[model samples]
Target: MASDYYITADNVFEYSRGNSLFDGLNEDQIKTLFSISREITLGKGSYLMHEGDPAREIFLIIEGELEISRYNAKHNQNHVIATLKAGDTVGEVALLDRGSRSASACAVSFCRLRSVSFDDLQDIADKDKSIYSIFYHMSRNIGERLRHSNDVALQAMEKQLDEFKTRVTLGNFFVYIVIMLSLFTFSLDGLKYIMTAGKNSSYITLPLTLAFFVFFIFFIKTSNFPLSTFGLTLANWKKAVREGIVFTIPFAAVIVAVKWVLISSVPHYMGRPLIEGLTAMNADPKTWWMFLVIYILVIAPLQELLSRGGLQGPLEEFLSSKYKVPLAILVSNLLFSTLHLFMSLEIGLLVFIPGVYFGWLYSRTHNLLGVWIAHALVGTVGLSIVGF
Candidate 1:
């Protein structure tokens, strides 16, 4: 719903004084314009107007943000072309051309605006010649928008040309592999503890993992790849988590089935329950709940960042093969599995199977949320609950 208010002459000037749309207007002209203008407040997510609708009024934004977008009927999507902020004027194109709106506008946040109808503007023009200045300013604003659009298009083309010129080569892939292997050396300290029985690896592994994570961040920043390339952003988090859950359910069921087969067919096989495994690793079973929480929140996300985001993302970019995605996933998991060899050959092989799935999921979404969720759940269920 929208609220209407009567804006005083003083309030009107305060709002319109520095606005480009009202430039060169005198005190008397501004006052006359506001006299016929309506002050309206729109809540967030409210549509100001739809594309193809008759545009009879031009609005000056005093506060808040609005998205100007075009709807594609074929795609069933709205592509936001621009975000209008305070001091921006909207719907001026309709006033100039006497046509419908070219784009739809929806308030991004609570908005306060003053709108003047075309009919009222014509009446003002008949009474006073000075009103033509407002139209002139509106035309200038349209020209500025056109120039900005051209500049943005030119920048996009330049970026594509640059990418084509410096396309990643096999040498680039080898360089990246070398860097990752160099970083993997730091984890050997934790591996020694895992290999030695009765020596809890958590104290050693935790700090080592944190150090590796810090170095990973440094490498990513220096390499000039945006964090999004590694799926560290909050974009589409809900969708990412939803896809992760969808992937995880069937994967978890498969793990359970594998556990069932092992228990039923294997002679004298003793399944390692999560509690017993924690105890065997010298972790306090009393704090088992806390460990599960940390595994889900911290441990899972950290490993995903290293394996999928850090390794696989760049591998995909560097590989020119038609099957680059699968190759990247395979190569990344090879390194991922190799790191666990210090623990045990069996453990290393087991880790590769899930690492492949995680890498594939990361490739599809390119967001951490989904892969992180899947990794956390699979790890918890396989090692802790289902007992691999």
Candidate 2:
């Protein structure tokens, strides 16, 4: 087997430029170019450049494929911006403008690349007009390719969006079928069971909740999701927490006002009495302290571990290969919602919407912090009324 290694200057010079923008370079110029360059190898699944990071150097791919992606917030996915094969150069635009990189670059295989710092290349361009021409032409060509790639990506996104609409329609149709069949099979019995279950649910809730937490922890331990995928370390966690609190203050104020208004003005829309029962449970000092301990030490961390850490990580890897954002979101969201079935169908659906949103956020940002914060916030607010 060929030893996969990093890009180096010697191999970079030997590599044929073919019809690339750099193809105009003669052998002598290519050799001269090698003088200022150094080779570096990247293992499969390694990053070359991250979006929004300073573009300090230009990369010439000597082997394997390089994937370029831009984060799409609306879709909550990483959109493929372009792909580069051997002899392709990346970050030329960033080099010219001294701007942050617009896309992230990752090595798809064990690959080699030749890198030249922007400062060094600028010096060469200043002294050698020919080199400057090469740089200008390469930059322009790359820009044109990027624009074309963007157009193609947009078309693909539109197509995918249409497909997503179709899938959602199909999914809803299936759900209706299931609901109808269930109603036909056990109408009165099912209604009675639901009513009885709701009345007696408190006895089972604690055990079910504990089971869910345990399973969540196990899922996290067994999964391969990278904890720091979004550059979220302990330091980032603290920062995110601070930001989360800031965001929640305004959001909570609005929610509280809306809830108060609805409760006071609308008889039919009166809020559920569930919160009152929870509030009473929480008002007991001993119960409140225990609830706090369970949540802070157990529930919050475990759920984050399972949902964001475990589920989202493997889900990203699996979906990345297929490149089907909607399907990935649906599957992951379904799983998230299914785990909450013991709660209530209404609660499950409520959690599902955010589950899909969080999955998308994870795919786009490649970070777990946002979803973790959202999950924790939901639990804290919803559970706080009960006492935790």
Best by lDDT: 1
Residue-level lDDT of model 1, residues 252-277, one tens digit each, is 99988877777677764446442335
Top candidate on TM-score is: 1
Residue-level lDDT tens digits of model 2 in 21-116: 556676666666777888778888899988899888988777778899988889888867688888788888887778999899998887778888
Determine which window of 10 residues in candidate 1 has minimal summed lDDT.
Answer: 272-281
Error of 1 at 7 (Å): 71
Model 2 compared with the native: what TM-score?
0.42
Question: lDDT score of model 2?
Answer: 0.62
Clashes of 2: 9
Q: Cα miss at 76, model 2 (Å)?
A: 5.5
Clashes of each: 0, 9
- Candidate 2 worst ten-residue window by lDDT: 222-231
Q: What is the C-alpha RMSD of each candidate to the true structure, in Å?
A: 13.6, 17.9
CA lDDT of each prediction against the hidden true structure: 0.79, 0.62
